[model samples]
Target: MKFDTIIIGGGLSGMTCAAMLAKNGQKVALVTAGQSCLHFNSGSIELLGFQEGKVVERPFEGIAQLNEAHPYRKIKTEKLAVYAEEARTLLAEAGLKMKGNAEKNHFRLSPIGTTIPAWLTLEDLITLETTAELNGKKLLLANVEGFLDWPTAYLSDSLSAMGANVKTASFTTEALAFARKSPTEMRAINIAKYLDKAQNIADAAREINRLGKGFDLVLLPAVLGLAHDNVDLLRKAVETPVECVATMPPSVSGIRIENKLRGFLGQHGAVVLNSDTVNNGFFEGDKLTAITTEKLEETRLEANQYVLGTGSFLSGGLVSDYQTITEPALHLEVEAHESRTQWTSEYLFDEQPYMAFGVKTTDDFHPMKDGKAVTNLYAIGSVLSGNSGIKQATGTGVSMLTAIAVAHNILNQ
Candidate 1:
């Protein structure tokens, strides 16, 4: 098999890069190993939420202050602004409706009800320029009866503290009740599956409408829109204005984004190999010639260029043994500490060194092998070492901007 470009890992970065290239008429192929971190998203894309222990009001300004090794530094601050808009446009083209921009960061209500800085928030979620916006408003917090993931109490308390007239309600349909029979399967995704039907959506809407009378806004757990935008249907059914708060994974909103983007890739003629893993890379001299997957053993999949967006340790992009950490796919050079003891911090909340550990890359985002840059292989997203997405709150931004930058590099070349 051959393609213009082959991207390993179909997470945010890989998908973004594939989508951009495919849209521009490049024959692209993407291989993904099941689930992505999008399952844990909060319905928002954060660009540098916190910098130097402070919330960043403007993402570009905060990105400018990032360290030399941070992925954002590779593109430089000025180009990031251009790519930021392009990323947003690409996502919009993929059917994601979002609010906010790269220049200014808005605040999205977290699962626990605290506000977090975000570059773009899904349209169905609540975003505020300031906490004062929540003051003096009538709000209703609604959740599924058996769903334990939604923190009703925390959300109510946080909203009330912001001076909002808060009320809580629980509503469930027959399908939702049926799903609750199995405790282990009673997750957000399961609830969303049951609630996706027409009758279930209408039943839930009726209950919410009854409880949401005279309320300024009705907030429900983000359990709608997994396979489709059922939230829109629910909103149309209920008379009151309705919105969703992000719930614990598997995030319905994130999954929706992934599905939309993946669908877009297919629509644009891109081959997507889901639930497949890249097991080996065939390299010659300083270039990666082809790769093989677990499913397609011995059948070499060749491409002119390759993208490694396999993600960090959590996603199995990079692995750590007793002696050292290494990039598993191609044995690419990684940036990490030698001693295992130095990989972590004493405090759980403190900065951990391992999170910043990933494949070392050049200014153009090419992965290195034996201290030499791989001519046709580029690493993007969390796979590149330097900044910790968890600590810096730049995960989504890095995944997106780096992917866009790499796509441009491939297209121009």
Candidate 2:
């Protein structure tokens, strides 16, 4: 089938945009690596641009001015503000909600609170068991041995303050019977995914229920029950109203968000082609024509415009390996010091301002390849002009807003 547009990469940016475009009644196709950087993200809408430093009183307004300053800075501030508004609306329509101000408000986040607002409490068994399809559930708190995670004592305190009734039991591969197989592993990261597969919620619940007599619900890590090959069984387990709460990185809220977004898109007739196609990019003159896939072979992606939201180095959104820090799409110059060796420090929280790298975009963010638009593709998020502290605060919101602006601009075109 012919599509109106083709998107590359399936991280948060790509999938979120796919949901928005499909909802807008456009024929969109997403080409992605399926489950890319989403695994390592914080899932919180970030904008750390000014939390601990210089604050752009009118953040979006500053983005417009950046176009003149750098190739990566080519976004219109007004458009970004509008995009943020729409992104919030869509997120709520999709089941999650972010409350508060763009500059002062926090979004709903999990695994780490305060960093992101709008987080629903997974600790509240009453809320999870009652509001969610789960009740009388047993939640598993799986943590990696010796890994520093957000304080559990602090989290439990917050949960109690919120009137939640939940208990946490932590075990390393050392304690569980599985420890014999592997010394260090997450139960949810490994085991739950398998059980959620080999046995349906009912069967496994029955089997495990037999082993440990208690609540009928089993709440575990976000990656739990779905990391392995056969995952449909885990889906079957949700039959008994089993639910998984969101967790920190390596298992950010990406999967949960993706699963929910896919449902929303499907209901609206949007077809999300998983990463099964051997796809290749086709450039026609100054524009991307159609994408060629192994299955479809060749097709037309005759859209008015495109949005690029692939993230930075860690997320594979941009290239930050060695002496370079540029997006292959625009080839904008990355702001680097004398040596790539100084890219980062071993201590992640050392606050070396130089380590947070990014592209310096043109006012319109088309990327200046020899002082011209690099194929009319607009770059956003970690791929474009950004500072780690600032970006850490607003990364998710930044991607959504910019993509929305790109879509709107395309509509006008």
Clash tally for model 1: 0
Expressed as tens digits, the lDDT of each residue in 128-240 for candidate 2 is 21123223334433333333343455544444444445455443332334432653444334444433444333444443333333434444344434433232344453433
| Prediction 2 TM-score vs. true | 0.63
lDDT tens digits, residues 370-401, model 1? 88999999999999999799888899989999
Q: Number of clashing residue pairs in every model?
A: 0, 37
Name the best candidate (by lDDT): 1
Candidate 1 lowest-lDDT run of ten: 223-232
The CA lDDT at 178 in model 2 is 45
Residue-level error in angstroms, candidate 2, position 395: 1.4
Off by over 4 Å in 1: none
TM-score of 1: 0.96
Query: All candidates' lDDT scores?
Result: 0.90, 0.50
Stretches of candidate 2 exceeding 4 Å from the true structure: 41-43, 48-50, 53-81, 97-103, 107-186, 189-246, 276-285, 290-303, 328-338, 345-347, 350-356, 389-391
Candidate number of the best TM-score: 1
